[model samples]
Target: MKNVKWFAVDIDGTITLNGNGMVNLNALSKLRYLARLGYQVVFVTGRSSIEALALAIFGGTTQITIGENGGVISTAPNSHKILADIDKCRKGYEILRCELTHVNEKSVFPRMSEVVVDRTFNLDEGNRVFKEKGQDLILVDSNYAYHINETKINKGFGLDSLMKALDIGYDEIVSIGDSTTDIPMFNRTKYSITFESSTKEVRNTATRVVKGENGDGLINAIDWIMEQKSYCEII
Candidate 1:
């Protein structure tokens, strides 16, 4: 947490448990405290831009959010910047939809820039088909869902946009996530934290791995960071 001014976090599976929905109250309390300590706490998530806005408003964030697996920026409530062209995304979906299994629009969450479906589908084949079509769309899997976004759109890109908007540098941000999509953000920041339940690759790539899982893990990471900085006022 040294030199850190912002905490970019993934929502589902990072700050929220399997049944906690958005996040547990305890985790949200800790996040609110962190924001009160004058740090920008951002939610870089695979959830929709509207959900990101709700989380941001609740956490008192610096109005910077990365949603849709880095394909969308919720710059303000009810307003969003979509990284992928809507027409291209629709076309790609039309092609990729046929390759999926046990999934459809109903199984997917509403999103601004990309389509998010359950992991029960055939992800590998979907990617292959999209590539064969020469579409710029790419499929990214997070902790619990798969996001189809533009080729260059990812957590890192969304974070870069947020940082630029805030006039913040990479070194001042701490990126925490629990999925492969987070690897890009890990590459963009100095402080990277992953949950214990994260994939082996993510844990190995992250700078630190907290002991607990999900929301509890996030709290643990925050406690460790605060300890490193020797600041206990949040308690």
Candidate 2:
């Protein structure tokens, strides 16, 4: 691509095909190719490091992962060094409790870390469900699968940390995601994109909206970006 050194992609609906429970081999290979071409690919997802780690292991280390919306990151999940850790996470959860009087203490951090404090619930009955049983946190939605942590650390903060680590300005980044939490990155970047299956809140904020849903849309968008004369110059 052009001089674009870093690529921030939302993992759930964008990279892995939301709800499929499988990573597209073709798409994963393309991502690995992009990394080989010298672009820093970042998987920005609402999933926690644990969930992201599962996908990264399955994808075979093609790109770095930013998990818990943006709260934590690692080159790979099992690795000890965190790319991002909002120490204020616990504090954020404490605040969430004050604002949301009835929310279960176990589910507050992971859910509120990245986005606004909307609501909370018990693990088994949430809109987004965490796959790991026994963990008090679970996403009750179809869009993301993250174990609830003690803070709302999420994609927005995660992107900012990644940008800081790379010493790149916000204007130099390209953020692509498909949910409400992706809004922060969209608002901060020079170019922001959302998949066709993205929530309305995400699509409305994007500078461009790709045609397909899930991983298909992400692959198409990345291909389109690579075709642009300006983007081609990045590599």
Candidate 3:
């Protein structure tokens, strides 16, 4: 759309080829092209802010990144804002560790705001435990891992934070993702895109569903956006 100035994209299943954490060169190149065309591209992902920041630095996108499923927002190499309470996440993790079997932390980059664990336990059951215990924690599956974060925090919250920081409005952005964690982001933006491989919920939440998967899907989305009459006029 003509008002669109920023592209908020999920990194894992959205841009990474096959969701294996491999960078999709073609998709990355498209993002770089968007940057060259004066559109800001921000990486919004479930990975650690540090990891996502690194990708932004090398991927030729904006320097800012939203990571840890809206729990962390990193703007520079050593600068970041923590939006979730790590102490609460740790408490939830302890409770889960004691009540469930095989619930262990996953080995990942150092996280500043949340706890991540393997997808070895029932996510609903884990959240139920939190509810019964009067905890404000929630367990969200990114399809890559399970994250323990504050119930109020989500990608939409992260996007809001970014909007405030950048002095932009939600209507000026388009979100693209392929997972449940991305639903909040989809709801916040006027235009959202997802792949055919995404879950029904994700596909339904998005404004558009592309036929391609992963990196291919991202390329298709960019191409489609570029082909729009308003977008062409703006360019």
**Residue-wise C-alpha lDDT for candidate 2, range 77-171, written one tens digit per residue:** 45533533334434443444544345544333243233223344443443222222232332323233323343333466667776777687765
- For model 3 the local lDDT of residue 118 reads 99
Worst 10 residues of 2 by lDDT: 127-136
TM-score-based ranking:
3, 1, 2
lDDT-sorted candidate list, best first: 3, 1, 2
| Model 2 ranges with Cα > 4 A deviation | 57-63, 76-152, 230-235
Estimate every model's Cα lDDT from 0 to 1: 0.80, 0.60, 0.91
Which lDDT tens digits does candidate 3 get at residues 91-155? 99999998888899999998889999999999999999999999999999988899999998899
Better candidate by lDDT, 1 or 2: 1
TM-score of each: 0.90, 0.68, 0.96
Worst 10 residues of 1 by lDDT: 100-109
Worst 10 residues of 3 by lDDT: 226-235
